[model samples]
Target: MSAEIAEQPAAARRTLERLMPQRESLRELAQGRRRVLLAARGSSDNAAIYGRYLLEVVAEVPTALAAPSVATHYQANLDLSDTVVVSVSQSGSTAEIVQTQQWARACGAATVAITNVDGSPLAQSADVALVTQAGPEVAVPATKTYLTQMVALGVLADALSSGEALAGDLDQVPDAVSRLLQVDVAAAAEALAVADQVVVSGRGLLLGTALETALKMEETCLRPVRGYSYADLRHGPISVVSEGLLAVLVAAAHGPLAEPMADLVRDLHARGARVLGIGGTPTFAELCDLHLPGPDLSEAVEPIASIVPAQLMIEQMARRLGLDPDNPRGLSKVTQTEFAG
Candidate 1:
């Protein structure tokens, strides 16, 4: 996992370069598509969450995350003729994901598969395939593949919107991620080592980062971690915040959502919850009990860069807890379900 995380900058560069030539295809696939639906599971589902925000906010398209069982098991037919349905899978063989892609194509929607394997069933079923090009990931926890998937989503966003601004920001991501991997997260790891439960919160695009971070902690550290957007947190989850609870807040430095995240940090601190802030702002750093500063970048591209330190902290916490992050108990690198067959 550590090696793969370290390889992210290079992997991101390769993924962006590979997707650049596919811009025309991406544009065509999204041409007349009025809405976007994403089908994925596990870590890829987290990537889809980011994709939802990107496509909706940047491309001005409505997006929905698909429940694969609805199509695969319930056999519910969807009117996706005017929608672009995207399947995101690492191996591209997850049965339900593949089934969803096939179902979408049959419904007259343009299907796009974002996967590492070019020859996988999901890739073959899609009208367009956007490969992450992260090479082979052997760790039970996805590091590089998850990061590269976000990069591919960024490229797709640019292609759909016909904008070069995000692409320019993405070009700098590799070096920024490389710099983040070098930062020592031992102190932050130690701070979270004794937590009985964790709550991760963010807003907008960074909510996906929060979700992935919580999953990483749960899988590797064997802790119960719940993630929510800042607004959702206040709805009911805020009542759970108290002493001995660990709260991780992700904030973008220069965005409308940044202030609310900072305010949430202060609120959590007042409630006696230990707050750890991850962002590129001085105010966020000062407000949290502990802070991990990320690379200065646009919020659109920050999701790929912000996740690095959180992954590092999870690795450190796993070691501190005497667990092997490479092979977490009761988990496999590639999960094949009954639907795949």
Candidate 2:
């Protein structure tokens, strides 16, 4: 699992190299599609959350995350004639995800499959297949595959946008990830490893990062961890914050969402939570009890790099807890959930 985590940079480069060339074609699909619906489960679903933001922000198109059960369980027949359904999965064979793609096509939506497997069911059946090129990820928990999926989604966002929204040829991401690998997250990991309560929060673009990070902790660290958007945290989850709680906040150094996140930091601190900041600027780092400063990148793609710190931290945290990430209890690399209907 550690090796798989370290391979993210290379995996991202491979994905970028393969997908960037298809920009025009993918953009053509974007130009014709009136809306988008993304489908996935588990880690891939978190990537879909990121994709939701990217497509809406960059393409100015209405986007939504699909509730596949609507079709699989209730068998609701709805028209998706003008929608583009982009389904993401590390292994394209996950039963429900593949069924979702098949159902979307049945609903008249143009389908796009983003998967690591070249010709898996989900990929072979889509109108366009954007294989992740992340190679075979043997770890029980997804690492390189997740990052590669994000890269592919970012490329799709660029394709959907009128101008270059992702920016910088997307080459900087791998280097940024490589640089973050050098950061010492042991202190933060050690601190959080023994904490009784942990919550991860990020607003806007990095919300998915928070969700994915929390999942990593939950799976590998064998603990109960919750992830919420800063906006939504106040709605319910914030009440649990108090002394001995460890909060990890994903914040950009400066952006529209930064102030609210900073405010969240202050609020968490007030409530006596020990806050660990991720990907914040040096100035913002002062607000955190412990901070792991991440690479400064553009808002559109910063999330790609923003997640690396937590990935590193969570892996270290898992090891600290004496849990083997490769053998995270009761988890398989690919989960298959087929509809019984």
Query: For candidate 1, lDDT tens digit of each residue in 8-57?
Result: 98999999999888989988778777888999998999999999998888
TM-score of each: 0.97, 0.96
Error of 1 at 157 (Å): 0.5
Each candidate: how many clashes? 1, 0
The TM-score that candidate 2 achieves is: 0.96
Q: Residue 160 deviation, candidate 2, in Å?
A: 0.9
RMSD of 2: 1.6
Off by over 4 Å in 1: 162-164, 337-341
lDDT of 2 at 64: 99
Q: By lDDT, who's the top model here?
A: 1
